[model samples]
Target: MYKKSLVFLFLVFTVCHGDIFEECEDVESESFVSSWQSCQSYVYCDGDESMLGECDEGQYFDPETSSCDDAANVKCFLDEVDEPSVEEEPEPEPTPPVMEQPTDVEIVNTAPVVKPNCPNSDDPSQVIFMANNASCADYYLCYHGHAIEMHCTNQLHFNGLTGQCDYPENVHCPLDEPSAHKCLPHITDFFPHPDKCSYFYYCIKGFLTLQQCPFYYGWDIERRSCVQLNVAKCYGNSRRA
Candidate 1:
């Protein structure tokens, strides 16, 4: 009975080994052995029950083909190295234009000179004076806010007396030209002069002569002589009639 029991145990172990690992004998090289068991050396499951098997070395289980392969061949990730990661590249923005500064010194411009008023007073435009007096011939013109004197041509002198331009010869004694010029004493008209008692000009023959009345006397034009203004005469004139 003991001898029979030993035989039985040997047969059981042999059968379990055979059932767990398929014989790698006909597998010509290490490649076939690894492929057959996926490099599992100790544990292997064939159908249902697990048993022991052997692999050459340095290899792991490959689930896909259900076999053992080389360390280089077995992979949990087969396409890991083969598949490249796809990444998006961003587009570059457009560059702005550059402005260049001038190196040379910039020239600053000066404002132009301007004249303040009208070009000339001689223009056809007429202007009046302080007295509201205006005439093309005798008037006042303004140049830069100043009055420019104007006059009429040839033989015409402004008659301040009559407010007209008359001959100088025509404008005679007792000059009615106006105020300070009025009541002019002349060679022809013997009039009383406030300055001397009297003073006069007389045209004798072709010669002109100056004559003065006595200190206390004045010239009387109607009498044509120097007479006493009061009751006195400084002297008697033979020329006086």
Candidate 2:
């Protein structure tokens, strides 16, 4: 009996801390856990509609939903700090509240908008939620009307001018070291593919792999991360290396 208890503890530790994760049909899978994510995780927020997805190289999270239209889109903005270019986002349509919520998590709309701001300049008055912010790495929300400063996974910062998090070339951040983003959500494992937006990733047993839908197809959230959505008519030859 004591030996069985030890094995159970080990399994719990691995599931909670191990980097392994597999794709599932829904949040009901045995692997489902709140806030779980993989080693390389990225996310986008559409007015509380925060979901994990990939972004283009060098580009930071932009509130411009158009910029984040699909996984395959690319972006790379370079600008200075202090001169923020956070654009105002239009009011989004009312949708169901987010599935995951902590007791202390502050509501964006209810929170006062008077940000000093997140690593990336959010709507100067509102919180701009990104999967990866340079400071307040995780579980940070409005601190007295000011969006909490986000930190890079390990080494990064939000450039006010470019409106993204990246290396410190001209941006007003440390110029010596660099960092990467890590999994923050309870459900940490799979996310959109970083390089090939058409693809998403699956992490299991400390291993990660990129996955994509069948030919000329795209990911349909209502369906499967990998499915034949047949949106190729809108985008010719939707295949990329």
Maximum-lDDT candidate = 1
lDDT of 2 by residue, 20-132 (tens): 23322233332222222221223322222334443233323233332222222323232221322334355564343334444675544443322233354334345543332
Residue ranges of candidate 2 with Cα displaced over 4 Å? 1-187, 191-196, 214-241
Q: How much does candidate 2 score in TM-score?
A: 0.22
Q: Give the local distance difference test score of model 2.
A: 0.35
CA lDDT, every model vs. true structure: 0.38, 0.35
In model 2, state the lDDT of residue 124: 37
Q: Best-fitting candidate, measured by TM-score?
A: 2
Q: Which pairs, if any, clash in model 1?
A: 34-68, 38-67, 38-68, 39-68, 161-177, 174-184
lDDT of 1 by residue, 104-199 (tens): 755534322222232443222333232113221343334434444556456344444443445655644232222321233332332233333355
- What is residue 97's positional error in candidate 1, in angstroms? 99
